[model samples]
Target: MKKSVALMVGLRYTGAKKSNHFISFIALVSMIGIALGTIVLITVMSVMNGFQSELQERILGMVPHVVVGERGEGVHDWPEVEKQIVQHKDVIAAAPFIDTQAMFKARGNTRYGLVQGVLPEKEKKVSIISDYFIAGSLDNLKPKEFGIILGIGVARSLGVSMGDKVTLLIADGGTVSPAGFAPRQKRFTVVGIFEVRSEADSMITMIHMQDAAAFTRKGQLVSALRVTTNNVLDAQWTAYELRNQLDDKFYVSDWNYTHGTLFKAIKMEKTMMGVLLTLIVAVAAFNIITTLVMVVNDKQSDIAILRTLGASPATIMKIFIVQGSLNGFIGTILGVIGGVALAINLPQVVAFVEQLFGVNVIPGDVYFIGFLPSELHWDDVILITSVALSLTVLATLYPAWKASRTNPAEALRYE
Candidate 1:
């Protein structure tokens, strides 16, 4: 028999329903193992991709695309820096800002917070802070006027709302008095409340640019120039460009530069997890080797007859290799289909599981995102499939070699 003919016969022999029950059972297990491993690996990769996507959108949306400040102390001319940064191609908007850690008070209540001083009109161009206006407008941020915007959480904590008065206690750099360090306390009417669903809701407060300047002791100069970009990924290069265009005292930082270390760690973790799971599929493939070798052993007499009829060693080898490989190929195809289906419906699947189990699988406080996320990337599936197919092919080598080396005379003599 030619090698092609032998391979077809071998495949038929292995898959024959009336074949030995033991061989069939082992084949079943091998298929199941491959299917399960592929499903798990694909599902995990999808979830990781989903998480990375969500985190990037939210982080970039809420945070500044780039921040330009003084490298040593503070920038004396924030307006000049802002002007230069806006010249970058991706930069959509730039605004002068001063951030201060301070205490807020209303109705004898107190809470620690980050107070942001922003240019009412310009800040809107860069950040969505204006879009979140559940209350008054930024135009109400009149210079030297006592007005403030609070996050919804901060407003609720301080027991105040729009049109209500609150006191901002500048923690430092206020005019000193006989009593103590005189607080630059201003009883400002709450004009707006915004909700970002992040720590920002509790930590962020907004005030007029002039008021923020006086409190921070940065007269006529803002602490940082907040920038928004057309493409968030271009932030780093934009920062670099801003620095290059400006003087030595100025420093620019992009979103990646600020959060690079944390992202690097996540990348490491994802790689390790994929490697650990791939071993499961590899171990499963090895079982195919055992199954093929056993099949070769049980059919020794049949092989001898085939050899007498002019079957070549290569033909015998091709037969067993095809049979073992079919087990891998079938499982892999099924796994890919099932894995992709699960990834596509993961959100609803998670919701169903939660309801069925009557449990909270993902607690909102623990995870930055509330829902189970999934993003199917075809590239990842292709890569995983290639690795699996390679491993499956490798499992056939030893068994195929053994079958090819079978001695026709020795086997037929015993029969």
Candidate 2:
């Protein structure tokens, strides 16, 4: 009976007529504040999640998940080693590759990049590089043809195109002539151009393995064995396992060893962004406190009347708690609905915004990804809603307590 009465009176106070327009406006502001804060927090966090995920796909997709190589003489028996590595269920595919750092000059422009010698058919098993081909076929890199595939950015920088000859000069390459031992140089026909929309696109070029072996003077010996696994997230552990399976003469490397720092930095930035944006919700929660305080002041007479009519202080407190909590609850529901709807379609929203503003939000050359991404995680939604609701409930306590302490005689005297 008491609970029902408290609820009835509390709701009546919340829905007070337009005569108390100031109180109504304040309540409306509090709700709007909470709603807006939740929406922004959810939307921003989703975008950050999207960035981290997309970076993983773009960066990791082109790089080896794990590499196996001989510590001393390189992987001379890479074919046998690849067979042994694949016996482990975690490894899905393995490919032989030779990697070297070199400078390429073509059409009067020069660029320094990594030159990788790969078998076209086997390379497809371990990498998604083939999927990114803009021109020419991987099969065109026939053995002894000395044909090369260049990144789009690298080709553009060097002003070269399909069928154009590029000169590759390596640090270790050169025929020793008595007076001048010059850099070993080889001419390669540009057979393909690939674009991954990343830094890799500017600094990676590929050629046939036999051509690389001849250029490096390591015939039949590959620099490394690249392997892809069933689970990329578990690549480091799988690499360690592969190392254990191999003799001490061989060493194992993974993508984490190569690009872990970059991914870690991205994750740290996302966390920091989440913490900073959460403060917006905190500020909105403060407005809830203000709203409840004003409501307490306006309802003092009502509260006193209820107290005189046999209502306990606890009931008064519960009344105001329910009232304030309801406001927050309503805002939270609306915010979640709005936030989820917006986050799921964030890419389209970004596109629309870019069009409206006449700007390119994510240019392919400037950013690793050419589109804005949003990945709404259920965990983030739950956490944000919980925090918002908790803040709103906590904000009500002090004002509710003050309302509960109203002296009926003094309140009635003023009335």
Candidate 3:
């Protein structure tokens, strides 16, 4: 019965039509603040998660999880190395590649880029580059014919298309002539073009392994054996394990060596954003402290009456705790509903706003991804709600204790 009385009185104190309109208004403001803070935190975190996920998918899909080769030397026994690498449980596919830097000259424009020689069918096993073909076909890049596949941006920059010939100049391989060492030059037909829509699109070109070996004078040896894993996130660790499995003289490298810093930076930014937003929730929850203090001051007479009627101090504490907790609960629930709905459809929201404003927020030429992405997590919502409620519950303790210590005689002296 005492518990029921405490709950009823506590609920009454939180009613909308309370005697003190100003105190009621303050309580409402506290709830709004909490809801706003939680909404922003959840939405922002979801967007960050989406960006990280998209980047991993796009970048890792194109780059191999691990690349194995002899340190500063081409892999002469790549077939044996590939056989060993694929034996690992995590390795999905392995392919040999020859990489070299060269300049492609076409239509009077010259652009320097990395030229990779790959066996089309074998390369398909380890890379998604073939999946992004915008023009021409990978099979057209035949061995002896010296056909080449250029990136979309590269093709656009060179103003060349299928059947057009481009001159490839390799400074490392040359024929000794009377006019000194002239760079090895070869004409290749542009057979295909692919678009990843990133910096790679402007800088990567592909040709058959036979032609690449001939151009670079590397014979049958490959620069590296690229390995793809089932899980992209495990690339770095898997590369380390592969190094140990192979001979000590062999070198192993992963995407981490080239792009790990960007990945780490994204994660750090997400964490810092989460922490900063949590402070906003904390600030909102702290408002409950001020609200409860004012409520206690307004209801001094009521507290004293309850005490005189034999109500225990613990009951008084429970009363205010319930009241403050109710406020926090409402705010947390509201925030979760709003935050989840917003986060789930954030991309659509962005598109709509962009269309309405006649502006482009994410341009394909400038950004890796052309649009905003969002992925709401239930775990984040639960954590934010729990933290806000805890702060609100704790905020009630001091004011509740002060209310419990009220003197009935002193409170009623004026009456």
Candidate 4:
């Protein structure tokens, strides 16, 4: 019966028309603020999650998850090394590669890039490079043909296209003659172009492994063995285990060696952004304190009357707690509904806005992706709602306590 009375009184106070219009307006503002904060938090988190996912797919997909190489010039028995690498359960495939830095020149233009020598058949098993071809085919890189594949950015900078010739000047493999050192140079036909829409597009080129061995004079030796793992996140651990099993002369590396900093930076940025956005919800929750304080002041006589009529201090506190909690509950629900709807269709909404404004929000050249992506996780919504509600409940405590302390004589005296 006590609980029922508190619930009845709380519902009446919350729904009753207020004499002070300003208090009602302030309460409305608090509710709206909470809703707006939640919406922004959820949407931003979803976009950040999407960006992480896309980067993992586009960038990590193009690079080796794990690489096993010799500490010296090159791995002499790469075929045996590949066999040993694939025996690990986590490893899906392994391929031989020769990596070197070179300057590519064509049409009087030169661009510095990392050149990778790969077997077309084995490379396809370890890397997603085959999926990103803009023109030509990987099979065109026939052994002894000296065919090359250029990143789209490299081709554009060199002003070359398929069937055009490009010269690669390798400084490391230069021959020292009686007069001076001469750089090793080779001419290759541009047989393919690929675009991953990342720095790789401007920095990486590919050719046949046989040709690379001949040019580098490493003859039958490979610089490294590229490895694919069943799980990209576990590649580092897998690499460590494989290294322990390999010869002491071999060194092992994983994607983290090259891109871990980028991922860690992204994660830190997401955490900081989440903390800042959460403050908005916290501010909105604090507004509940102001709203409840005004309500307690306005209803002093009512509180005193209830005290006189045998209501306990705890009952009065319960009434105010219920009222304030309702505001938070309603706002949280509305915000979740609005945020989820917006997040799920963010791509379409972004496209529409871009079209309407005649502006490109995400430029393909500037960003790895050309579109805004959103991936809403239900856990994020639940977490935001819980935090908002907790703040709201805490904000009600002081005002409710004050109302509970109302003296019947003093409050009725004013009435």
Better model by lDDT: candidate 3 vs candidate 4: 4
In angstroms, give how far residue 226 of model 2 lies from its true place. 0.6
Order of quality (TM-score): 2, 4, 3, 1
lDDT for each residue of candidate 1 in 1-415, tens digit (9 for 90 to 100):
3766977797788668746788788888988899889999999989888877766765566678888888755667777776777777878998888888888889888988888898888888877767667788788887777689998778988999889998888755677778867766767889888865445667788889897777577788777888898888777887778878877877778888666665566678778878988998998888898888888898888888888888888888888888888899998988899999999999899999999999867654356555678999999999989888888889998998898888989998866
Residue pairs of candidate 1 with colliding backbone atoms: none
- Of candidate 4, the 10-residue stretch with the lowest lDDT total is 362-371
Model 1 TM-score on a 0 to 1 scale: 0.84
Prediction 1 global C-alpha lDDT = 0.81
The best candidate by lDDT is: 4
In model 1, the runs with Cα more than 4 Å from the true position are 1-4, 71-76, 104-112, 128-170, 174-202, 205-211, 214-219, 354-364
At residue 142, give the lDDT of candidate 4.
93
Per-residue lDDT tens digits for candidate 2, residues 1-415, read: 9899878877876776746777777888888888988998899889989988887888788899998889876788888998899998899999999999999998889999999999999998888888889999788899999999999889999998999999999977576778877888999999999987776788899999999999999878899899999999899999999989999999998998888998888889888988887787777776767777888887778788788889999899988888888888888889999999999999998899999999988876677777788999999999999999998899889988998899999888967
Candidate 3 colliding pairs, count: 0
- Which residue pairs collide, candidate 4? none
Score every model by TM-score: 0.84, 0.91, 0.88, 0.91
Give the CA lDDT, 0 to 100, for residue 73 in model 3. 63
Q: Model 1 clash tally?
A: 0
**48, model 4: CA deviation in Å?**
2.4
